[model samples]
Target: MADQAEKLRDMVDKKKKADKTHKVIAVTSGKGGVGKTNIVVNMAMLLSGIGKKVVVFDADLGLANVDILLGIKTKYSLIDVIKSGKKMSEIMIKVNDNLSIIPAGNGVEDIANINEPSFNKVKDELRSVVKDIDILLVDTGAGISRKVTFFLKSSEDIIVVATPEPTSIADAYAMIKIMFLNYKKENIKIFVNMAKNENEAVSVYENINKICKNFLKKEFKSAGFALYDKKLPLCVREQKAISEIAPDGKFSVSMKKMINNIFKENVKIYDNPVKRFFSSIFGG
Candidate 1:
């Protein structure tokens, strides 16, 4: 463990001297069961299909489900990398030519309660994997735990997934409020999942946006809505992306638009937000 930690430190030191910029986007939710991971997976496929290099980090840690949804069997996870001195590249399971994923194995509580040194080690190991990547989408676990907030703080943009349910809306607002108070992050985006239609999706976004503006004094960009489709569950069962199962489906069309809006927006990508994120957490 000590030797691996020392190696990680050396790698991080070298990474700091290199020049690279990767957009770190965190896709999270206020509560579980909101289909956040599915969005992350499909969105990654869409981004990759558009010629962008994408790497997904399943930051949910113990409760990771990205690999399962992708139908890929990972031999090693982030936990293995931390405990067994495995390389990050060794654990990465390539989903396609443009996309790869870092699975977080189950029962790994250490990642959720990571300390400064542990966080640094993990970040260092990830530096090479993320170098020159176009986007690094972190599928953070739901809720406002210390682990969740830490990932959010480190990300350049956050996409909060929510449904049209009142409970989901309330929880989503709660998450936005906490993020504003804690990190003062303004580059937040909203993607309405499981909506019945465009109106339902817009209504969900408006409700949350109004609350954020009136109460929290913050706003969120609409990444668009994914209509509730019966085929989605079947696709999930098959461990295939919606685009792969039903490319002409409404969900696939919606996701394509979401990807379009994401790149169309003239947002600024900061330099090494991952390093800054760790520094903020560790008080370095």
Candidate 2:
């Protein structure tokens, strides 16, 4: 009996250690048209370029376009995986050996409204695939709706992208405030996009961080920034990742710097991130 108990304990320990590979990084914003999805797709491509297994989970129910941005078409998505009971492996679009994308389906169904059984089944399906990836980059919808917040609150690494526009900055603050005041999520990160220069990017982040420090007593980590690149819009129109088409472009360079900075930080990892993410969303 003691030997059997020891074996069971060992099995549990092995499972916990294996589960640590599932790292969820949710990219979100307070308003639309902030280039949040672009950042997520590019980040996934860059991470996979460096030999890291990455999964781009498009959780943006309002605008699920990660598949479109990647120029990949999918017949099934999270909706099929959850509702029709399709296998996750079937719905997942394998972009490359190191990269895969899970479309969340059309921005119609309120994923937050899913019942407990469906939620648990989805969680199980996600767990089956999540164990094989190094990072899961979730592109959440723009805004602070309940669905958006659910993903943000569940993720250990949350990157809120905001352009240098005044409205964008204000909205970014509101999003951070909601996370802090409601969920007590203090380790939020910020990425300034479309800044004119490095100084402008840092200034924008500093201003937002200062405001958060003053009001919410929380200072978000800097996920770095990108300068205004004309090539970005062109790349988007062409439906290709900037990191792929223009690997040496300003956007790609900035993204590499940001990715490196994030990796350098000693961010916390989860024992079972996939399970935790769904459980938190569904109150499991």
Inter-residue clash pairs, candidate 2: none
Provide TM-scores for the models. Answer: 0.84, 0.83
Candidate 2 TM-score, C-alpha based: 0.83
Q: Which candidate is the best by lDDT?
A: 1
Every model: Cα RMSD to truth: 12.6, 10.3
Cα lDDT over the full model 1? 0.84
Q: After superposition, how far is residue 200 of candidate 2 from its true place, in Å?
A: 1.0
Per-residue CA lDDT of model 2 for 103-203, tens digit only, reads 98876556646666765676578778888778989899888886677667778788899888989999999999998898888678999999998899999
